[model samples]
Structures are given as C-alpha cells and as structure tokens.
Target: MRVAGLVLAAGGGRRYGRPKALVRHGGSLLVERASRTLIDGGCDPVVVVLGAAADPVRAVADLRGCLVVDNADWVTGMGSSLRVGLGALLATDSVAAVVLLVDMPGVTAEAVRRVAAGAGPAVLAAAGYPPGRRGHPVLLGRDHWAGVRATARGDTGAAAYLRAHRARLRIVTCGDVADDRDLDVPADQRGGRRG
Candidate 1:
C-alpha cells in the first residue's frame, strides 16, 4: 500500500507572529520543506492543508504535485486542519496517511519514512522519542480515520483518538533520525538549544 502524506500548515501562528507555512528555514518556506519531506519519504500523493495566508504560500511554494486543501475553519485550531486533510484523503484510494505538522521543522524525511513503514488499512503508528515520547508524523490507517476525525478537537489533533486506543498503537523510535520539537514563537527560529 502506498502511504499518503498530510501536511497541516494552516495555523495563523499568533504566537509565532505569522503563519508558519510562510516562515523560512534553510532558505525554503516551511510548507515547501514539509511537502518535499513527505514526497521524498515515499509517500505517493501528498496533501497540504493551508489556511492562513494560503494565497502567498501557493504563489511561492513549489507544491507542484501536492493536493492543496484550503481549510476555512483553520482559525479554530489544528483539529480542523487535520479533519480537512483526512477528509480529503478519505475520498481517494489512500490506504493510509502520515500526518506531519508544518511547524515541526526538526522532523525529517527519514523520520517520516520510519513512521510510515508500518502503515496499513488498520495500522496506527507515531514517531516516538526515547522512552516512548509520542510525536507527529503519525500514520493513521483508513480504519481509524473516522475515529480520529470524530475525536480530533481544537489543537489536540489525534491525541484523543490515540489516547483512547493506546494499546493498539505502534511507537516507532525516531529519536536518532529526527527531532519533534516545534517552533511556537519568533525566538524559536533563533536556533534555540536542542537538549
């Protein structure tokens, strides 16, 4: 099964001073990096959910093969973006999707590949730090899409659904390949100490 990818890049980033999708890191927009990460990680079709400053992101980002989704309710939170991204995937032949957050620049293509390796129609896996620190690039099989869509609320994303079904979840250790820390404020882009 070809695992798809979802990049949730809709947040206005009130705390970060602007939309994270337009933020530059390593000379490329965050949105561009994320979309490329998924494609390079072996995801056949990638979907990018955009909300805040969607037009500017579309104009500059090289999202040639990505399916761009405009989440109108993005002001509400990450939940809406997740819901929108998942909904878009559910309509296609996508067996599963690996969800990546736009602000999490530390996550790499290798980490995404690691997390997506265990994808299936009934699989649920997430990248984990040492000692099982669950993080993004979560792979949700089609079987759990409805559950995630229902439980995802506010900025929680799949936390509620994942928590309820913790026993069946697979934790992929990606601490060596990537970092899950996200940029929340402008200072976060100052190359903060990673410890």
Candidate 2:
C-alpha cells in the first residue's frame, strides 16, 4: 500500500513563545527534521500542514519535495491541522498516512518506519512508549480518515477516534529504539542535541 507522510506543523506554539516549526534542532528546523524523518521512513509525497508563521517556516525550512498545505483554522487547535493534513493525503493515491508532529523532535525515522510498515487502508497503528504509553507518528488508514476527521476537534486531534476504535488498533513498541518526547515548553528547548 502507498502510505504518505502527514506532518502537523500548524501549532502557534503559544506555550513555547515561538513557532515550534521554526525551532532549531541539530542544525535544522524542527519542521524540516520531522519531514525528513518521515521521508527517510519510507513515506512518499510527504504533506506538511503549516499555519502559524507559515511564511517564515517556508522561508527557513527546506520543504523541497513536500506538499505544503496551509491550515487557515490552525488557531482553533490541532484538530484543524489534522483535518487539513488528512484531507490533503486523501486527495492522493495513498492507502494510509503516517502522521507526525512538528514538536516531537525525539521521534525518529525508525519509529515512523515501524508503524508505517504495518499500516494499510483499514489498519490503525501507533507508536508505543514505555509502560504502554501511546504517542505520535500515528498510522491512519484511508478507511478511517472520514471518521477521524469528523471526531477531530480542538487540540484532541484523533484521540477520540482512535479510542473509539481501540479494539483494532495496533501498538508498535518504539520506546526501545526511539524517543517520543515533545518540545512543548521552554525547558524542552533547553535540552541538548534535539532530533
């Protein structure tokens, strides 16, 4: 199946005091790192949703080979970004999508590839951290796009939808090979060697 990459980079970074997409890590912007991780993990035609400081992110982030999408309703929350990204992926010939967050600089391509390798048009997969915690780089099959979009609201993203379909969800244990830390606050930004 053809699985595309969907990077949600529209957050305003209200908590972080700056657009997280533009945040630098390992000599590259966070958005660039996220997109590159997806591409390296085997996703084709990566689609990135941009909103907060879209112009500046475009200017700094090397978005070459990516399908950049503008989410006008990004201020509303992550749900809008998710909807916009999934919609863009739906327009393609992709059978599923590997969803990554721009703020999660710790998630590596290995994690993305592990989840994406098991994704299909009707499959649902997510990266699992230690102690059975679920995190980003979610694999949403095309079959669940409409339902996920319908339930996606506020900053919840696809949490509700994924919970509703928990019986069929697959959890890929990635904690052993990847970190799922998110750069949400200033303290997270202070860490060394991100990404």
Candidate 3:
C-alpha cells in the first residue's frame, strides 16, 4: 500500500515559550526525529506542516530532505494545520497518510508502523495507552480526506470523525503512554527526558 506520512508542526508553542518542534530530544530536533520515524517506516515522500516557527523548523528539518508545508492558518487552530497537511499530501500523491504530531516525542517508528499497519479507508488509530487513555496520530486513507477538511466542531479533533464512523475505527493498543502524551506545555516537554 502507498502511504504518505504527514507531520503536524504548525502549533505556535504558546505554552512552551518556544517552538516545540525545534526542541531537542536525544540529540536530534523534535521534527527531525518525528519525520525520520515515518521515513524509516517506509513512508515515502513525507511532508512537514509548519506554522508558528516555520523558519527555525525548516532549518532543522532541511537536512531530512522532506517537503515543508507552511500552514499560515495555524493561528486558527490545530484542525486547520491538519487539513492543510492532509490536503498537501493528497494533492501530491494517491497514498494514505499517517499523520504524526511534533510534540509527541515518544512516538517511535514501530508505533507508526503499528498505526499504518491497520489503516483503512476511514479508520483512526485509536491508540490505547495506560489504563485505557486514548491518543491520536490516526491513519487516514485518501477516501476520508474530504471529511477531514469539512471537520469543524469543537477542539474534539479527529475524534468527531472516528465517533461518527465507529464501525470503521481500529484500536491500536500501545503500552507506552508517551505515544499518547502531547507536549503542549513546558512541563511536558521536559518530563519525558528525566529520570
């Protein structure tokens, strides 16, 4: 199956005081680390959606050689960035997209593979972590692109779509909560690296 990976790095990082995508984790920038996982998983022609700190992010990500999409409407919200990235991925290829978040530092190549492995026309990688808390980075087939674009409810994100099409959703259980953790605040960004 043809699969394209889209990394969402359009967040402004208002809570973190700096671009979270540019933050270092284990000697590599967050975006670079995230993109590499996708690439390593055999997801070719990856694209990164940049917004708040596009320039800085681009500098670090340039070496990875992935396409960088600037999401000017990022201030609008995460939903807008997701749409832009998905639209870009769809516009260039016919492959299904495995959307990855920049702040999710612990998301590994194996996890990405697990998510994409079970991808379908309208399935969401409802990642269950620790005690049943669910997380995102859902896989979407090209068929659901339009629905994702039309989504505009609350901050509920892709949950709305998955909920509406419950029968189509697939749960990819993961033991690592880090795959589910979103590093939006300063504390989250640091805690992952500590003892």
Candidate 4:
C-alpha cells in the first residue's frame, strides 16, 4: 500500500512571532523543508496544510509537486490542521500518512523512511529519539483516521490519539539518523509554532 505525507503547517506561531511555515532556516522556508523531506523519504504524494499566513507562504515557498490545502481554523491550533490534512487524503489511494511538522528542520528523510518502513491501513508507528522518547514523523494508518480526527483538538493534535494507542504504536528508533529539535526562537527574537 502507498504511504503519503502530511505536513501540518497551519500554526500562527504566536510564541515564535511569525508563522513557522514562513520561518527561514538553513536557506529554505520551513514548509519547503518539510515537503522536501517527505518527498525524499519515498512518500509518493505529499500534502501540506496551510494556515495563518497561508497566502504569503504560497507566494514564496517552493511547494511544487505537492497538494496544498488551507485550514481556516488553524488559529485554533494543530488539531484542526491535522483534521484538514487527513480529510484531504480521504479520497486518495494511500493507506497511511507520515506526518511531519514544518518547524522540525532536524528530522531527516531517513527518519521518515524508518517510520514508514512497513506502513499499512492498519499500521501505527512513530519515530523514537534518544533516551526513550517517542516523537514526530508519526505514521498513522487509515483505519484510525476517524478516531484521530474526532479527538484531535488544540495544539496537542494527534498526540492525544497516539497516547491512547500507545500499546499498538510501533516505535522506530531514529536517534541515529535524525534529531527532533524544533526552532523555538529566532535567538534575535522570542518564540514559534510548528507546521
């Protein structure tokens, strides 16, 4: 079965000041980096959910070859973005989606590959970092989309559903290939959010 990519890039980044999707890091916008990562990771089709400064982001980000969707409720938080991203893929042939946050520039395609190694409509997996920490690049199977959408709310987003299904979650160790450190502040400025 095919495993697609879903990027939640709709946050306004109240903490980081500007929207995370527009944040430039390592010579590329966060949204561009995220979409590229998914494409490089072997995901057949990638979808980016835009919110906050959606129009401005589209004007500059290199989101070519990917499906871009808008989240009118993005100000509400990541949950709404997740719901929208999942909803967009409801008609696709992909059996699962490997979710990536736009703010996490450190997560590599290798990490995405590991998490999506054996994705399926019934499979559930997530990347695990050092010292026993389960983090992003989460692989959510099609079977649980409805439940995830129903419970997804606020900034927590898919976290609530993953926590409840911890037993079924296949933790893929990705510490060797990637880091989940997110850009919290511009150093020159103050804070930020994720995509």
CA-lDDT, candidates in order: 0.91, 0.91, 0.73, 0.91
RMSD value for candidate 1: 1.3
All candidates: TM-score: 0.96, 0.96, 0.87, 0.95
How big is the positional error of residue 132 in model 4, measured in Å on the Cα after superposition? Answer: 0.4
Q: Which portions of model 3 show Cα errors greater than 4 Å?
A: 152-156, 176-178, 192-195
Tens digits of per-residue lDDT for model 3, 104-166: 867777777777885655455655676666565568777887887788332454667767776
Clashing pairs in 1: none
What is candidate 4's CA lDDT for residue 133?
91
Which residue pairs in model 3 clash with each other? none
Candidate 2 segments exceeding 4 Å error: 192-195
**For residues 1-195, what per-residue lDDT tens digits would candidate 2 score against the true structure?**
789999999999998899899998888999999999999999998999999999999887898989999999999999999999999887799999999999888889999999998678999999998787898789999999999999999999999999999999999989988887888887886774333
**Clashes found in each candidate (C-alpha, N, C closer than 3 A):** 0, 0, 0, 6
Candidate that beats the other on TM-score, 1 or 3, i.e. the better one = 1
| Cα-based lDDT at residue 104, candidate 4 | 89
Q: How close to the true structure is residue 154 of candidate 4, measured as C-alpha lDDT?
A: 91
For 6-54, candidate 4 gives per-residue lDDT tens digits of: 9999998887788999998888999999999999999978999999999
Against the true structure, candidate 4 reaches a TM-score of 0.95
Q: Lowest summed-lDDT stretch of 10 residues in model 2? A: 186-195
Candidate 4: clashing residue pairs, number: 6
